[model samples]
Target: MMASFSGVLMGNSTAPRHWPAWTIYLRTMGLFCLLWYAMSWLTPNKILLPSPLDVASALRDRIDDGELVANATVSLTRLLVSVSIASLIAIPLGLAMGTSRLLEDLLEWPVELLRPIAGIAWIPLALFMFGIGNGLPIFIMIYTAFFPLLLGTAAGVRNVDRRLISAARTMGIPKGTLMRHVIFPAALPSIMTSARLAVAASWTAVVAAELVGAPSGLGYAIEYYRSMLDTPSVMAFIIVIGTLGFLCDAALRSLSAALMPWANAEEKR
Candidate 1:
């Protein structure tokens, strides 16, 4: 038994490679479509779980009519703006807090207190404050994105080697130069990872924020269709949301690889 267990452990040491990404995606999605079709057929009410073909047809109609593009663009634009704002604030604040014990002490409590709260929980209050427009969704998404980015940056900064900083200082490097040339580069991978998380979190928040607060967006389209018992269209918008999020993450990964050539580009794998 011991020998067999040891052999199994040794055998598993090398990770098996998967097929090319496109093939993997198609295979997975094909299975998913088959499962969806089966469920749709089994369901008594077809409207509740529309067949894959029905959803595809609806999706095509939306695409042809340009509603899909308009709403997807709106949602994507909000995600970009909110994430940009969150990154601007969080990165600098995280760097400062991570480096300075005093500053970290001052801000740590507030961060801890608020980070536990879900972004969707703020929608009710925000809806009242922002009153049904772009501001509400943007505000919620920024809040959602902020904590992940801030935490990621601080962690990256903290993980940077003290040895490197000391070596740079011993060589008479300026404080600003040491930070720019040593700390930031070392922390770039972690920061990029956090940026992706921030983007995802904000994207999720935008949907919820828009459901109650905005006149336009993917969330609004989903809700509008749901109200009208248009499950196929709802599913279409959902598929669009998921595809956009995946594409956005892929773009970020490419950017990370380009920026940090020495690091493993597919670290998550």
Candidate 2:
């Protein structure tokens, strides 16, 4: 087993072929493990701070029990589903509102009024309106992601170059074709950026929602650890959440880069 593990590590060429990235990753993992060990060994109190070893043990136990995987899967699923729904509506509505002065004026005040309200604050109202189970957290995630995406989309559409639009018209392009090809593509970078932000926000909102009464999720795990006074578990959960968020953001960024390579020029300019 030990030999196989070593071989696996050595074979991973995809992991930092260079010394710097490899060294940094190794050091980071080592530091985290060391701190965890020291906490477990030196910490006299379990309630205030469980040692790193204890948290690892708990994590292992939970994994064995199949709780961690289940929770994580549930939370991820809720996030994806809710964000999809929100994106479907938000992108189109935002485009319409952004491109049309009359629609923008009509929706602007209502969106502004609602935008000020925090996701957590809406828990009570959501619970009352949508009820519990998965609905509350799903709604919260959608709610958090929706506004940023909508605003970004609208702003992008509004900021489309008039010259390009005029040129498209001169070429006898239909309004729909112009919007589909010229306007949306032009504003894609901004829309993508907002979508990234919205995804991050959605994760935060989902965590908050899970905290309310979620049966299984990272948020539930944190709450469970807190209630049980397991500090290590709490810290572990925090690390997991942060790591997941970072990964999600990185993935979004990668996707944006892939879709809009020209956006890179905008950055250089």
Candidate 3:
């Protein structure tokens, strides 16, 4: 059964062959659209689950009115800014924590205490602290993304080949130079994986963060038309949110592939 699914997805070969990315995407999307249309036809409540054509029409209206562009731009910009800030702070702190036992011990209690708290749980307090605006969403997203980045960096650094570190130190390499050349490179793949996770986490959080706190964003727009029983537009915003998240992850994946060719080569092993 798995092979059959793989054959359809990957290629004609039951042995499971490689398929072009576009081919896989089209096949999956086509299947999804078919199922959706079938369900919508049978459901009798088009308002709740409209056909693909209806959703597409709603999407086109958004594009034509400039609402889609404006809201998507705001959400994506906030995503970038929040992830950047998270990486800048979390990655550095992660590196330090990974390297120093004492530092980790000192911060372990607080980090653990805060780490388990969901970002959405912070929304109520954030609303009170930052009010209904950019601050709330940005703060929520930052909190959402920070832990993954920090933990990934720390774990990546800790997992570095100790032999390599010893070899460098034995060669009389300075601490700064050794870290720049060896530790960072060795940890690059883990760090990149963490970055992808952080982006995803941030993206997920942004919707909820925007849904209640933000004045304008995809989430805000979804909630806006939803209040008026605008199901198609709500779904339209949902589709936009999904599509943008895919693009953002794709961009990050491309960046990881481009910047870390060695990681790719290693994975082929």
Candidate 4:
């Protein structure tokens, strides 16, 4: 089965050529819509699971009124801020830990100990520390994004070919220069993978945080409408969140493909 799938992906003799990723995505979405419609038809209570058309209508109304855009903007802002901070802090520390055994020894235990804790688990402390505001959501997002990026970056750096590092050093290149030129490029694919994961984590954290403590975000909107038994509105907000997350990941993948041609080629293979 795996071989057949790979043959399909590679357009080999054993299987027909696979559809483009976007085409497959569209087909999957269409199937999901059909299933959703069928389920909505079968169910007696629209409140429990509203029809897709009803949800779409609710989404359209929100979009026309600018409420959806406003809430999405707030959520995206928090995601951006938290991810930016996490990247800044994690990248350099990850580099240091990867390069220096002493630094790794110093930080590894603490990082490992803390990494197991879920970002959602920090909600209470974040609320207490930052209060019920943007700060709380941002903190939660940062907490969610930080560890994946840190671990991914450090692993990437560590996995860089020893021969390449030795060759650079043997050529009398400065340590900083070697790191900037050799280590960074070699580790970029792993870092990019981590960044994508971090983005996903940031989205999840922001929504979870907003659901509990925020005043203006998609998660908050969903929670508010849910309380009122506004199932269509809740579904609309959820659809918005899922769409935004998908777009963000797609954007990251496109950026990675543009910036890291080698990585893209490897993936195609």
Candidate 5:
């Protein structure tokens, strides 16, 4: 009889524990849905400020027309290519700067001066340099993402523990091996954070570049809708942009967290 009572009590306790998480999730979702509905219904004009439903309908139409996917793919491809180029250039430059004090001193002033300038500020120059093709926006995106990555990698390399370097040297590790195995691992989390920031910056730059002159992209779609006063379509594009940015951020964060589990543990500590 006592065993039966203990088992029943444990089962009841476990059941309540599972219920709380589900209950909280449901309540939060319900609140968001209610707010969304209220905002859509209460807004005055569909053209001026369309409801969520209107945006949904517009998005559906765009998707059905196959324009959204194609444009999105172009934008995404451009973003990826630009970021890849930036990473390749930035990482080597950062390493050189971190390893060589003289080089860092030489570049510091120029970087400090240039980094303050907005990425969009480069658009006119890029347009002039690359003309009105894919290169203009790609250049802007690369510029937007590059500085942060370089600075972050440099900082990370500089911050690597002296003790770790010493230990590697004591173990008869070659200088290259020490850098590859010790410094790189120690600096990786910081570099990952920088990369995440670069991705966001690149995403923003790409849209701005598209707005300036691209014939097709999410940015162009928004510009087109704005010109037409089609609030639903504009809102849809905004949602899509936000969604993509959020997804990129989330994915990078997940990857960073996985690569640097010590970061999470350190946070708790």
Candidate 6:
């Protein structure tokens, strides 16, 4: 089992080499579409689960009308802004906490206490604090994205080799320079993984926030169509969400590969 796991991680020949990753992904999605179609056919109520064709038609209409594109733009903007702000704050704070025992000791308990709380759980409080506007959704997205990034950065820093740090200090390298040259690179893989996770979390939180308060966005569109019993439209929006999430993750992976080529090579191996 361990050998198989290690082989998978190392991209070794544990399985048939003929099936590439993209081929497998395509096959899986094809199977999913087939299943969806079959389910839609078998169901008596089309309103509950719209057929793929119905969803496609609705999606095309929304695109032509600019509704989906406009709302998706709003949601994407909010997601990007929130995640950027959270990353800005969390990365430095996490690095500081990981490097400083005093700081970690002081903040550890409070962070632990808050980490378990779901971002959606704060919807009521956010609504009360920020009222009905972009602020509510942005706040939720930030709350969702923050901790994963913070924890990932801290873990990355803590995992850095003690010998490297000592050697840098011996060479008279300044603390900031040591962290930048040695620590940040060493911890980048974890940080990137956390960033991908943060994007997913932020997307989910933004949707939920829109459902509750926002007048515009993909979530609001979904809710609007759902209330009107427009299952096809709702399904279309859901497909949009999944596609956007996949795109966001892919973009992050590309950025990670570009910034940390060595890490990317190691991962491929």
What TM-score, computed on C-alpha atoms, does each candidate reach? 0.90, 0.84, 0.91, 0.91, 0.85, 0.91
Model 2 lDDT, residue 261, Cα = 84
Q: What lDDT tens digits, residue by residue, belong to model 1 across residues 1-269?
A: 77667767787554354688999989999999999999999999988999999999999999999999999999999999999999999998988877888998998899999999999998889878889999999999999999989989989999999999889999999978887899889888889999999988888899988888899999999999999999999999999999999999999999998999888745555
User: How high is the lDDT of residue 50 in model 2?
Assistant: 73
Query: Per-residue lDDT tens digits of candidate 6, residues 137-253?
Result: 999999899999999999999999999999999999999899999998888888999999999999999999999879999999999999999999999999999999999999998
The Cα error of candidate 3 at residue 67, in Å, is: 0.4
For candidate 4, write residues 1-67 as lDDT tens digits. 9988877788888575478999999999999999999999999999999999999999999999999
> What's model 2's TM-score?
0.84
lDDT of 2 by residue, 68-96 (tens): 77888898899889889999999999989
Q: Could you tell me which residue pairs clash in candidate 4?
A: none
Error of 5 at 8 (Å): 21
Model 3: what TM-score?
A: 0.91
Model 2 regions lying over 4 Å from their true place = 1-22, 25-43, 265-269
Please provide the root mean square deviation of candidate 2 (C-alpha atoms, Å): 7.7
In the range 12-96, model 3's lDDT, one tens digit per residue, is 6546457889999999999999999999999887778888998899999999999999999999999999999999999989988
Across 1-269, the per-residue lDDT of candidate 5 in tens digits comes to: 78667777878553333457788889997887678778767867657666667788999998999988988998999989999999999987887788789999999999999999989998887877887678888888999999999999999999998888888899999988877888888889878989999999999988998987688888888898899998888888888998899998999999988999998899998
lDDT of 1: 0.92
User: Between candidates 2 and 3, which one is better according to TM-score?
Assistant: 3
Q: Total clashing residue pairs per candidate?
A: 0, 2, 0, 0, 0, 0
State residue 151's C-alpha deviation in candidate 6, in Å: 0.9
- What are the lDDT scores of the predictions, listed in order? 0.92, 0.86, 0.92, 0.93, 0.87, 0.93
